[model samples]
Target: MKVKTGTLNRVRIIGGDWRSRTLNFPNQAGLRPTPDRVRETLFNWLGQTLYGKTCLDLFAGSGALGFEALSRGAKQLVMVEQNRPVLDALKKNSEMLKAQNVEMNHADGVQFISRETRQYDVIFLDPPFRQEYLPKLLPLLPERLTPEGVVYVESEGAIDPGEGWEVWRCSRAGQVHFHLLKRTHA
Candidate 1:
């Protein structure tokens, strides 16, 4: 459901230095932020601390996952958002939090991934649920991750972890099927 323009909606940081802090974001269609429970669970699976880890939040909507990582001690975070208004809101939230570790990019997630050369310790993939981006994006992830890196994916339905990848953790919350994935060794 799309949040009406001009209506204020907030998402709270679940843990870390900014625990319990709330960030207000403009609601746009297809801009669903990962739910608090899911974030908490995902982080728990990730061990609750991201100190010195580099992260990438592809298709960053409300900047929720990226900001959460930063709050939990990620050394660097890159958030890529395509929507102008949503991107503006993300930038505002980053500035409000005085976030120095975040790098906001106004770009398409697919395009960014196709050209990105640096590897990330953790990558968050939460594209618009209606798009069939997973089939295309998943194939590109392994090369983007550091050897021990992980990819957190949120989808509307079950996802098949294609070649060279394995599901490390999986759970469901309502209609969301979230998974933590890792690359399999040859």
Candidate 2:
């Protein structure tokens, strides 16, 4: 059951079970899927397979990171998107892919994360760059991540991982500055 909201653009999954498969997302402001090269590098840094890992995509704009994680062997995935139309398209794509062990939430990412009790092995954080989302959201992530968990961030400029965290790996793709961050031991 495809969501018939409007004309949609497609982004191809870079690797894993759904590699080469495409998912549809609506044309909206500040909704950019992580580029293929960026994803490839990210997965390389995170390792090829994500078996048994539970993942969260807080700003699941196009379900790109969420779906990619699922395809790469994540055990469970939770995607939270505030936009109804975008969430609808994500549902349509998830159905099309027949993805399993996935949960969808139609709410603000920060709000969802604020009340979320479960810890995750990985969390994808790619919010709109125009707003100061990273600063607000970063402080909330440490508590949500398991001891070994990591956060993948995509932003317009370099991010300060705050006092107790560190950027484990980072790379640039055009204007996008992506990083993998983990909590540092004291």
Q: Which candidate should be chosen as best, given TM-score against the real structure?
A: 1
Per-residue lDDT tens digits of candidate 2, residues 36-59?
899899999999899999999999
* Model 2 alpha-carbon drift over 4 Å, by segment: 1-5
Relative to the true structure, candidate 1 has a C-alpha RMSD (angstroms) of 1.1
Predictions in order: lDDT: 0.92, 0.92
* Per-residue alpha-carbon lDDT of candidate 1 for residues 60-137, written as tens digits (9 for 90 to 100): 888889999999999999999999988888898999889987888999999999999999999999999887899889
TM-score for model 1? 0.97
Clashes of 2: 0
Q: Give the C-alpha miss distance for residue 179 in model 1, angstroms.
A: 0.2
What does each candidate score in C-alpha RMSD? 1.1, 3.4
RMSD of 2: 3.4
On the 0 to 100 scale, the lDDT of residue 68 in model 2 is 91
